[model samples]
Target: MADLKVNIGHLALKNPVMTASGTFGYGLEFADFIPLDGLGGFIVKGTTLKAREGNDYPRMAETPSGMLNCVGLQNKGVDYFCQHIYPQLKDINTNVIVNVSGSSPDDYAECASRIDALDNIPAIELNISCPNVKDGGMAFGVTCAGAESVVKAVRERYHKTLIVKLSPNVTNIADIARACEAQGADSVSLINTLMGMAIDIEKRRPVLSIGTGGLSGPAVKPVALRMVWQVARAVKIPVVGLGGIMNAHDAIEFLMAGATAIEIGTANFIDPSVTIKVRDGIDRWLDDHGCHSVREIIGCLD
Candidate 1:
């Protein structure tokens, strides 16, 4: 078998396959469908300092080849996660990364600090770029200064593998990524759903209640790959490529373009067992190429 191990900072993953946050809820919801240990890691739903009810109804819309969501980082808050969710996750053998989000730097720091207390969670994916939330989220991810401020504050409070999830909505994603690295981000994840909207001509209304939502799935794959490639070259730290990853082929494309690891997002909703399929497919691909290590194909774009 090919060696599928890879490292994101001090945290070591058995493979390069992980499930994206929001798409995977607390990593427990899919327990029956997938073997949790087979995954490199699974980022739980977005957690905040306080529980958010999220936006009104009609938060999801199905696009041609993708889906749009304005879920608004709905969660039961960090306290609930630490008190209730942590116990259930503590025994899991695989890496459990928390997807931390907030409206302010203090919120991010406080949440990260709280998750840091969890013995099972080895890393935190700082979500400074969630477009669905009207208060903060992607607000802090669009600008260099905004990204730096949040990351800097979290770095001081939370000590672990700090992975900042970057927003693709920005003009220069590389600049924002570089700022996160400068502020002590251990790793970076890219292309967190591009902003999109759909119309209901018959009703003369917007499909989603929020009018606009973040788009994911195969439609955004090209843009996601381009951003991942650019950001990977721009940052020295590892880059977790996500967005529009439906199969192992799509995942491999991201790896060759320059992602250290790939996260399956919308695909999980279509097939809960997709994570294992991607992982197995990658192993087969690696072995077929006579590559002993999955790392051999990473950034081998030439």
Candidate 2:
């Protein structure tokens, strides 16, 4: 087969397919549906310093070829994750990337520092871009200064490979990507659910109880690809791209556009096996194209 191993800063992954945060719940939920080990790594749901009840019941809403989520980062806090969840996943072969979020820079750094103590956790994905939260999440990702502050703060506490997941709602993705790079981010992952809303027009109401929610799925592929290309070209640090990647073709587009690796987000909710399918599809396509390795296809576009 093809060599799919890739690097994110000093960390090494066996392949380029990873399950996105919020989509994959602690890597244990999908064990039966898809082999967790087949993935290079996967980010568990957003973990905070304190457990959050999340938003109201109507947190998830379906849209045309996309999804809007105001799940409000409903997670069991960092200690619950590291103490209870991490042990169960320690035996898994792939890397475990912790997705941590907080309302303040100190909260984010503390979350990272806590997860960093776990020996099995190879990296912590600083989620400065989760649009579901009220005050901090996406707010920290929209500006160059905000992004830099969170990254720099986490850099001091978390020593493992740090991947700053960026928000697509920003005015300039490359500027924020560069800011993260400058703040000691080992890698950057992009297009974390665009800010969107669904309306019930009949009652002049919003479909999501939280009003505006984060939009993700095939509807965002094009914008995500463009941002990934721009950010990849702008920074020397590796880029992990994700935005509505549902199939092999979409995965290839991301690799060609310059994503070192990719995360299958809403696609996972549609087809839990999507990530594995993409991995296999890329391999088959590589075989058909007379290419023996998957790395040869990464960032191939001019």
Q: Which candidate is the best by lDDT?
A: 1
Q: What's the lDDT for residue 99 in model 1?
A: 93
What TM-score fits each model?
0.97, 0.96
lDDT value for model 2: 0.89
- The true-structure Cα RMSD of candidate 2 reads 1.7
Worst 10 residues of 2 by lDDT: 129-138
lDDT of each: 0.92, 0.89
lDDT of 1 at 42: 93
Cα lDDT tens digits for candidate 1, 1-302: 99999999999999999999999998899999999999999999999999999999899999999999999888899999999999999899899999999888888999999988888799999988743244444488999988888999999999899999998888999999999999999999988988899999999999999899999999999999999999989999999999899888999999999999999999988999999999999999998899999999999987
Candidate 2: which stretches are off by over 4 Å?
A: 130-138
